[model samples]
Target chain A: MSDTQTTVEPVRMGRKATQPLLIVNDLVKTFGNGVKAVDGVSFTISPGETVGLVGESGCGKSTTAKLLLRTLDPDSGEVKFGGQDLLGMRGRALRRLRSRFQIVPQNPQTSLNPRLPVRSSIEFNLRAHGVPKPERVERIAEVLEQVGLPGAYGDRFPHELSGGQLQRAAIARAISTRPELVICDEAVSALDKSIQAQILNLLAEFQKELGMAYLFISHDLSVVEHISDQVLVMYLGRIVEDGTGSQLWNRPGHPYTEALLSAAPGAERERIVLVGDPPSPANPPSGCTFHTRCPIAIEACSTKRPLLKPTAGGSHAACIRTTDLQQP
Target chain B: MTVEAQAELVIDAAGETSDAVLSVRDLTTTFTAGGQRIEALRGIDLDLYPGRVSVLLGESGSGKSVTARSILRLYGASAIIGGSAVFEGRDLVGLNEKEMQPIRGSGIALVPQDPTGSLDPVRRVGAQIVEVLRLHGVVDSKKEAQARAEELLGLVGLPDPVRAARSFPHEMSGGMKQRVAIAIAICCNPTLLIADEPTTALDVTVQAQILDLFVELTSSIGSAMLMITHDVGVAKDLADHVSVMYAGRIVEQGATSTVLDDPVHPYTKALLAAVPTPDVPRGNLIPIIGQPPVSGMTLPGCSFAPRCPVAQSSCTELVPELVSVELGHSVACPVATEFGAA
Candidate 1:
């Protein structure tokens, strides 16, 4: 009863696990012209918990993944993995930390080397981390099998495989390292519908068997709802809503969150389609960053940036006029 | 000549067929691979009215794209088309390439899946549009073509028509490139437009905008659109009528709202359930539970029977013809009567 009633997880990141696998706090990243690609984004994943980061394109969900993996440096914030603050770490420390967290990019076509055989590409990862020669071949085949690819695929190049098979190999290579957390950045976006279901099933089963956590980031609300435990909704580099998957899907708090959830393609829901593009983060809206597109926007929404406040439904929303939004 | 090859143009000499722009009848296509004949489309019948949007929905190998290619006669020597795909009153099956060339763009145009792969990466996007306009004899002079190209770029909602006219395909994003392709397809101003999964490569926000662009283009040009896609939600968003395809055949055809709100065919029902939606309460979306059969594989009974829940033994013994369920609703299944009724 409590788990269903509360949107936040009843168990908060399993305080007893062998240190948090990954932690991000007050993370901010800005591209050229001071466009904040990621702003004040924070979350945590325990040993085996999966947190879904959901948003539309340009909401900076992918940037959050890149920041945690250090593929892109954060302007200001903290990323602590395995109890070590990663922002200050450099050289071998950073490289050593990277080995503990792996990323699987969205498009396998672009990610995998089309010219190289998939087996060699997968084996390259393990060998770089000093995996023994004899063990690498067997482990490569085992991981490939784990992601539902046949063991015989070790001899085939990326071009020989279908889109589904190519994506499976991408997952196999990411897990070949046996990292503590797998950062799947829209991993299934490019796959077909039937193939998407198979891959999602593989990821779920892998998590249960290996006890690994996932920092899963995707724009697809339906996909996140099917697989995620805790769901965080972002807009313009900032988290505007965070709760359990069912809670966010049903009673979304922020207006931007409402627009995104209702706009999910597969199922019919009451939707408020916004008109304008998200204001550029370089010179974002004065108060609430979403005030430009907020349907029931108020005067205060233009002057004051509201802090993330707890609603009665146990979800958090960064909207000062959330309660009054319903009033005429 | 055989009746198949000798059939005359049935419509009046004025190139009219009542309200319909294209009327396909008993169209079947086959292919030969590795010394074996492969039946891709057994038989498909469809009608397209002027200025109406229709979706040809199906999974991979369902003959959705095959039907599109057959319409254009682009399937190469591997194909052997049967029956007739009539357009503008002529049976397209036996037409020579020289005869088909003039009819290709002036009568109908096709927009492919990935614009990046469709367009020449080395060439300028504007030049490509200009080539299509000139090839179709819509514009003769280069200056007039350039002027029309700028107008088209603006029509598709590109920010600056002048700059976009000079841009290469690589300079544009996936969404922008798709817009350029849409612009080119509409440049010829064909009576009908065939788009095959045009938004598959784009993001969700960009997808909505592109769908919006299609609606805008259709209404402004008043061209009937045959949108072939696997996304049923998109069918709901854009299609005026819908036909659900399976194993290269349409199992269900009806007005979009009636079919989506109350589908008669078992395959149609299963397809509706398979697509994941946000508003449907937390439960498993029971997909069709299997992939489409391969193109060359021969199916004895109903193509969807293996995955259908209420399949009977009789369903595997004979192929069922599409019987009318109600006005404007028809399904190719014996059990179709059980749907939308007590």
Candidate 2:
């Protein structure tokens, strides 16, 4: 683990010296039905940094990504990308900003158009960004090759390609615009394990070559752990813990984070099986939302909500008992 | 006896005779779609021993699900299935729908992948389980069936069994619906349970709970389980025996620890290596090159030879048989079997 950490040291050190690429401050989004999908989440992503956002179903991880991209307008928050207020931008302004940001969704099968060939799908993004038609073909071919697909594959439809091939094409489309940031919302989750590794490795290689920041969102912790520099653990529309991959994986501060880390297969940590499913976002438990399922929930947990405070592990954890719990 | 000792005792009891609740040998299934015969499963050999879990591990289109479906004779008229699936001295392969009726739920039950899809959306979750119980004749009275359904709901760790029983499949969350599906599958106390990627659609925490429920229920009932999944972690966590499938054939079969920890077949090794594990450092995965061959695509020799890292000339000339490398461990690569020993 240390050797792996050392290998990624240069990437971390290079990014730390530079100003952050994107800064999300107190972002909040509540649906029409009174479901607070994202609540008061704040994080920063540096240039070429891969931030892994992990949570279970309805944990607001996807909602946060949507809010960042302004796909769904945030109820209230500040999203500053490249030092510009992204939330303030509208219409043509927002569309202009879109060239700098792109998203690769979970299912490549649905994300890609069945009617269009793989080349057109990638070219569509380039076309939208006002790239000349002459350059689109070359860019598409270059991206396809970068993602490990043959240039000839550009002629095939989505149905003609396998799940892995389709995902690579989806990635090719996402990166074709040469966006500064790419929000991959479980982009590799739908693919097979073998293909998942291929995609993960390709993403890592792309990050090194192009120096693009990634908002890698997924439910799979191992995938997150492998790719991310900083990992955020969300529970019930709130950031329960924010730390590095090693910090979250090796020494998770929040009980929810701890339970999640343990739940991941092949985790050597002692299993802390959280009882029951996550409470509905519309009807989250009072005080500490996780108290209902927290293994170490004290009386204070139900009476008072915990604030995200700095812990010994150089991570912020929103758990009242963070100091009391023994470090892993 | 203590819990650990008791668990060991049960394992020993099951291991003594190595009593396979279902023994599938040389099972093949071919589907004729669009005037083309596609081999979905080719010579799949697996055995599910009582009180233990045997996992059919593979990616989509690898015939893991087909194997489960074939065991129950669930395929329609167009499917041409061959070979034997001996359950209780009866071959399930040749059985017609009418013949398989009794065996489907009573002898073997399926907890399908998509819980919502498998469940009756119109019916109440409780009523569905009760219907299965009544249809299988597991319970005589409606009152008894209702009571049993509630008990099963509780057994699956569903909160408020009464409310859960009254709610429809659409009303329940994905995890709850899956639990209901599991409850329905186990209501009859079948000797063998076939869960096809049961937790694939679930969240990690929910998946852990469901898997824990499966282990607890199956152990207590002394039921053999055939757990099909593409996830290596799930197979590692749950399976006693693991069968790695590629292009509709078993490439490797052995104890979970043996196959996962030290795989022989290049495909198996590549599959394990490809998975992103917490222990493994970032950016270190060596992904298997090339996609699995599409169904109906003819391969001259080994199906995995095109993508196999250590393939030689001979690997492309002949499809190797599953040769024993160690006790209870077999690999389908002649090169690996011969060289992997060192």
The most accurate candidate by TM-score is: 2
Error of 1 at A22 (Å): 2.0
Residues B165-207, model 1: lDDT tens digits: 8999987888889999999888989998999999887766567
Give the alpha carbon lDDT tens digit for every residue of A173-214 in model 1.
999988878989999877656667667777877887776788
In model 2, where do residues sit more than 4 Å from their true spots? A1-17, B1-18
lDDT of 1: 0.79
- Model 2 CAPRI rating: medium
Q: How does each model score on lDDT?
A: 0.79, 0.85
Identify the candidate with maximal lDDT: 2
In angstroms, the error of model 2 at B131 is 1.4
Clash count for each candidate, listed in order shown: 2, 0
Alpha-carbon shift of residue B128 in model 1 (angstroms): 5.8
